[model samples]
Target: MRTPRTAAVLVPLMLLALGCAPQNSSTATDTSASSGANQTPADCAQGKTMKDGVLTVGTDSPAYDPWFSHNDPTNGKGFESAVAYAVAKQLGFDHSQVTWTKVPFNTSYAPGPKHFDFDINQISITPARAKVVDFSDGYYNAAQAVIAVQGSPAADASSLADLKQYKIGAQTGTTSLTAIRDEIQPTSDAVVFKNTNDAKTALANGQVDAIVTDLPTAFYLAAVEIQHGTIVGQFQPSAGQQEQFGMLFEKGNPLVACVNRGLAALKSSGQLAAIEKKWLSDTVDVPVLQ
Candidate 1:
């Protein structure tokens, strides 16, 4: 995903998008247990870190945007980058005390020891994932968007029922795939791709009517990746719940409580919202399909 260089246009649009409240009823699935109970963020983070005084973070390589910028995680310019630093600040680690390491997205949450204090790579909070690793409270609520080649039938859909006739596609194991089966419930079995690129290619080749992915990634595919791709619309993947992204941690790591404190403070103080506005503002324009 390409980061929008100009904040001039996207900021107001982002404000408008943020104004609409989510209709979903379910709360985020993962939250740190006893989040910093009886301890300050700094104290909760002490001695629990991979290093005594440094806050080590992990994210996948070639980090995409608008989550990361120019494939760099240390610049603190992208949404996740800025958020990670904000959390570190809340936990008392300054810029010079922080370090980043490469951790593949899947490996970051796998059942095993971890090499970083925390990992943030847009990993969603889910019951299954939470069983293996602890997660800070959700920092971003995500929506699924449909994308199709411009002028395709799927591009014309105005409602979920209108999409019932199409052969929808999504990457296997993603919430987008779950949306296809559980939300859209298309007439035919969905065309599951191995990854997002495969789904994008399928849409470009007219092998599938449409592809679904999180709204930000959908915007990226339509605006940057696929020359002819256009977003059809957006929707909450779960009918009554909004999907959310969380920072992952090793299970039983007390530092999760501290990170959650940072997220909580950022949310209440409006810094988190501001960071999201700066990076994800382009996502506001597409019509939302219910």
Candidate 2:
């Protein structure tokens, strides 16, 4: 997940991608509670704060490309980056009124209170994580897949049974690698990496046959940084396997309602679809978020 260093290449591609009409379909899951007669308060609170009035969001400092272009989360250039601002705008907050903070991925959803109004770092909503923090309706629904160098054994493995003999790598403590272990259970061995970059490098050096990551990250590596690679195929979600990215908020926080409202607005207005086409497709042909 590297940042895009050249705006010249990225900006035009972004415009071209957004020029088309979005496909018709709802992308967000329903997470709203039944409402009473008073809908004014709810309508006016799209992305607003309780008292401070400033929308504070948290993301990784060095956010990656196609998610946050060139580490500028405020610019709304990347898919999630633009979605964050879109959510803010729906909540009645201007871009200037919104603030950004850096939060490490590993501890962002830990079992405890949070310090930001909401966090948008492409975090997947899982049941285990739901025990600690509440997630807004999914802003993006993604799939997991394998990334392999061209002509490798994995390049031909289209199904779970086909991938059992390859050595794979996945970031530590992630479902991507877990899928490789519990599902594929490669015949050779599954290597572990601290991040996607490490896994990519390992693939380059022949340390592993393939690396399992979210479809978006796989697309990024295949299309942008690692021209030698390609995404094998997306994995089908098992009973506990589907992955959805959501706005992370503190457990029981009032901001969850506002975040969900903003997401619905963005999706309904086709803004989310625009962001998706711009960043995700240009980065990789495989649809990362739908």
Best of the candidates, TM-score: 1
The digit string of per-residue lDDT tens for model 2 on 234-275 reads 663554334567777877776666666666666667777777
* lDDT for position 178 in model 1: 76
Runs in model 1 lying further than 4 Å from the true structure: 1-38
Give candidate 1's whole-model lDDT.
0.73
TM-scores, each model vs. reference? 0.82, 0.79
Each prediction's RMSD to truth? 4.5, 6.7
Best by lDDT: 1
lDDT string, candidate 1, 182-253, tens digits: 888999999987667778888888899998877777766787777788888878754455566777788878
